[model samples]
Target: MNLKFYTFAKNIVKIVLSPAFRVKTIGKENFPKDGGVLICANHIENLDPPIVGITCPRDIHFMAKEEIFHLPVLKDILPRVNAFPVKRGMSDREALRTGLSLLKEGKVLGLFPEGTRSKSGELGEGLAGAGFFALRTEAKIVPCAIIGPYKLFRPLKVIYGNPIDFTEYRAKKISADEATKIIMDEIRALLSAGK
Candidate 1:
């Protein structure tokens, strides 16, 4: 599908499907209208990325697993939305390059810091990759969380927290692990507020 049409369709999906899900966002004003940003969210369900992406007014590029790119239908649409493949449990250098390049181009990149969806709906530990990218690119980290149920048409809530200034940490030359913990804590704070 064409990018415009796909985004249009995505908007429709958000309108029709999201109401049933009770999707809501807080601290949305913190998002920069046009610039590089890194949205680091918690992964609870497979539905997380699209749900968050749809609600946002801006186009966001999400890092998807390489296998999804192989699907014929996804091959056409996913890439247009700025999605690229990241080989799980591997270096995935190309994926990192693509993500950073997108940031350099002043686009938003969405990532689940946990790296994968948690079946139990509990918060998972964040990986160092997200921290590394944020540090390297000096991108603003917008901590977010997707809460509520995930069954078909079930009520869901997406909470966006205030964007944290990673620039200081980046400038300090903080380690990726340290950055990851800081980012994860912010995400946890958002989730806690929702409760």
Candidate 2:
């Protein structure tokens, strides 16, 4: 989709949903202006991507499920809305390449490290993909906390924490588990703050 069209669509969604969901954002300015940025949040709702995207200062290229693209309607609409497909729970090289390419262009990439939605709102252990991306791109990961259910007029809050840089571990032989722990600790702290 054209950049202008995407912006227009994003604004419309934000105008509509923000009020309905009673969405509130904190620490949005914590997102830096440039570089390959990663917005890492625990998934709580299926709408989390757009929920976070709407209030973001920069355009977010979210890593959506590959299955979504197979859907007749979303297949055409997702990419236009800045969502790229990724095979969940698999080492998808094609998706990796797509993610790296976008980051190389200095764009913000939205990732839900928890891999899937925590319907009960309890965060799960994060997948390794987020750590791998941080290692590969040397991107700053912004720990985000999204609190509250998606109910009509119920306040849902999204908090953006300070950026995390794992540059020190980039060239090191750190295990994915270790990287995940490091990343998740920051995320846990963010989540705890919202309580």
lDDT (0 to 1) per candidate: 0.83, 0.86
lDDT of 1 by residue, 1-195 (tens): 557875876887788767767777666777878788899998987777788888776788899988888999988878776688899998888988998998888889999988888888888899998888889885778888888787656667777777788867977999988999999999888888887
- Residue 10 accuracy (lDDT) in model 2: 90
lDDT of 2 by residue, 1-195 (tens): 457767988999999999999999999889989988988898988888888989889999999988889999889878887888888878999988988888878888999988888867888998888887787786788888888788999999999999986877877868776787788888888879887
Q: What TM-score quantifies how close candidate 2 is to the native fold?
A: 0.95
TM-score of each: 0.92, 0.95
| Clash pairs for candidate 2 | none
Q: Which portions of model 1 miss their true places by more than 4 Å?
A: 152-154
Query: How does candidate 2 score on lDDT?
Result: 0.86
Weakest ten-residue segment in model 2 by summed lDDT: 170-179
